[model samples]
Target: MIKIAVVGCGQIAQRWLRVLTAHPKVSVTALVDTDLAAARRLHALGQVDAVTATTVHQALALANVEAIVNLTPPAAEPEMTRLGLTLGLHVLAEKPLTVRAAPAQALIAHAEQVGRRLMVMRNRAFDPGYSAFVRSVAGRGPLLAAGETFVQLRAPGFRTAHTALADLGVHAIEQARRLTDAPVIAVRCTEHPAAHLAPHAGLVTLLLEFADETVVSWRGGYAGPGLRTPANGRWSADTATGSATFDGQRQLRVGDEMVELEPAAPGYELCIGDMLAVLTGGSITPASVSATDHATSISVLEAATLSLSTGDRIQLAGTR
Candidate 1:
């Protein structure tokens, strides 16, 4: 069993605790939050019976863990992951590796320089719901075009300007890559500020043109004025042979057949399993999200943010 320290006992941390504590190969050795009260609340609620600390430094001292499950807010993720990587522990971080592309890319480079395993959690690819869809695409050839959407009544931490594209849209970008296996060549974005709130871009529509000539359009809502009615959710990817559609639930349809998926382990569980598999002699697959791809997702979002701010499509560097 790999001893793991979970950082940030907030909303995401709750999920981590539930999944990691029960896993046979994982040990939730420590929990940390900036607010001791919040950390204590999760500790008591979970009945984890483990060491708890209010900071990463303190947690590291107390727990002899081999990995860090970082569920901290987007801004804190890079530093937290860096601390663990610096200490030679593998890190599985939540989406949007950092607030910007450059920092995220820097972390990836640092991880490589130090020879550590770094993975960003993109569970949609591992979701059992899409297994048949994955199989369908095997015979169909390269993904031609794709779309991924996530509409929520409110997006967490998106109350600030230019945050919606980064906070929520990043996941969609990852989804597009997972299905399409292409890099974003160009991006066009349109965003609207939240109603009755500070000039935060609460809603965003992104057009990502991929290297495989597959264009994935994605969009979502944040804590804005108000969410649009019937203004939520959709994903469809087409190859020359066939197309697949996600019902935004667990259902996906390819051509005329439907593949229903029973709920598998929670995303965190699958993600931790993926990390441990690699750490314990599991090889990385072509389908897996790599450090480079993770960084590119942030870059695409950064381009979208720039596109929205400039009211002009941004052509990503080094793509045709």
Candidate 2:
């Protein structure tokens, strides 16, 4: 059995631990968090035997861990990942791999050189609901019109300039890139003044043009009261035959058929499962890494920042 250690005892960590404990093929070896008490409490609930409520350095040294599932905030992500990679431990880090793109690239490069698996938690790709949406729309070929919105009406911890786009829009931007073969050639965003988060609450719209004459427009933001679907996030793909709406709960609607899928798998479990599968002589797939780079996501966010500052469209440098 693959031994996995979960670092960070936040809510996301709890979700991961819960799922990891339930998986029969994997063993939860250690629970590492800054707060030893919190980590122990969570482990008790999950029935995990080993627990380390200390710094990653201490936990890494103590646990006989094969992989570390990082669930820390954006600020601590880079450092933790760097240490884990240096130790030759396979790392499955939370997304927006780093706040900036350059550092993220360097980390990925190091991971590649060391022959260690460095997977980012871009779980939305594996989301059963989202996957259904991808399959429903991909058949249309070269998409014409597509829009994705990821807005956080309520704060779910960590509120920073990077969080709006990197944490949330990473999924949307990636989904857009996956749904449409075209890359985001240009982008524009707007932000409020410092009094109102300056450029915090803004909108980012991307214009993508493809070789097949296909065009895709994607808009994402965390401002205003967004989306009528209460806690409802859906990716609707429009085709000539009709449109399919993949509800957040793993239900799909294409044409006249509305199929209810089994409660889709949880994101963290899927991530850990994929990682373990690879260690046991299975090959890693591109699906995980295709959108793992948060640099493009950060760059697009940077453009949005500029647009908000100048009140004009900020064109990307390479989109031409």
Candidate 3:
């Protein structure tokens, strides 16, 4: 079995633990977190018997671990990812890769240099909602137009005046890119503040023009004001063909057609499985990285954030 180590025992880390524990091909043999208590909690959740560490180096020294699952915040992501890659261990990191596109690209470069796999955890693609989306466009050819909305309810850390597009828009943008395989050539964004902790309750009316002549419109908010019906949930994708809609959330639509799915695997589980497969000398495929897509998707979100703040259209530079 492939042995794994989890770094950063946050909410996403817990999700990774749950999914990793369920996969028969992998075993989470170690845990690491800045907070020992949090790491203990994750250890308990996974029912793991391995010792927990307070740092990446400590975890790596354990000699039983083959990969690291990084669930840390964006601020700490690059450094942690660097550690894993330098140690020749595969990494499955939380989304947005880093706070911006530049550093994220650097991380990818380092991984390539070291021949270590770096997979971003973009589990939304594996979501049932996204599954429905893929089926809608599988054989239809290049898409003409697409749109997405990311809505979530009020919770602590829900709203901020100056928001990081990497946190919210990355999901929508990446999912769109994966679905369309088209690069976002241009971007424009706007945000609105509210009474919440952040000035803006939510954002509205964003646009991304793809190279394939596909225009993507996106809107998202957390308890955003002026909008009827507060949509408190994770990001979701949708697509349509002559009013026959395929929603990432609802799965089957209009008479239960079988939407082709790569599989129903969870993100962390898929990440771990792919890492182990690589250890056995296998190649990585889209299905393996279905939960992960780095580079260009992150650039779109970063560019959008820059646009939202400066009131200028930001073009993604050096996109892969």
Task: State the lDDT of candidate 2 residue by residue for 1-320, as single tens digits.
Answer: 77888888777787777767776777777888887887887787787877565776677577778778888778888898888888888887777787556687788788888878787766665665666677777757665555556464445465655345555555665566556554555555443222253345545555555444545565565655544231224556566667777666668888779988777566546766676567655575446543244456555555555555676765555521
Assess the local accuracy of residue 276 in candidate 2 as a C-alpha lDDT between 0 and 100.
59
User: What does the lDDT read for residue 201 in candidate 1?
Assistant: 37
Give stretches of model 2 more than 4 Å off: 139-141, 146-156, 191-213, 218-232, 239-243, 250-263, 289-320
| Weakest lDDT window of 10 consecutive positions for candidate 1 | 224-233
Worst 10 residues of 3 by lDDT: 228-237
Please write out the lDDT profile of model 3 over residues 1-320, one tens digit for every residue.
Answer: 77788888877677677767776777788889888998898777778777799987887677488788887777787898888899888887777677676787788888888977777665665554554555556544455444445454455343355452556667667656655656678899887755553444455557877766566666665443344322212223333543224444343343345443444554445555565566545565454353235666767777887887799987764343
The local distance difference test score of model 3 is: 0.64
Predicted structure with the largest TM-score when compared to the true one:
1
**Candidate 1 vs candidate 3, lDDT winner:** 1
What TM-score goes with each of the models? 0.84, 0.80, 0.80
TM-score-better candidate, 1 vs 3: 1
**In candidate 1, what are the lDDT values of residues 1-320, reduced to their tens digit?**
77888888877778778877777777778888888888888989888867889876788788887888888877777888898899888887888788678888788888888888788776665555544455566545556544544344443442466566776677666666566555678889987766654445366788887776677677675543344322214567788888887665567788888877666664446766666677656578223446666776777778887888798979887432
Judged by lDDT against the true structure, how good is candidate 1? 0.70
Which sections of candidate 1 miss by over 4 Å?
A: 134-161, 196-201, 223-233, 238-241, 281-289, 317-320
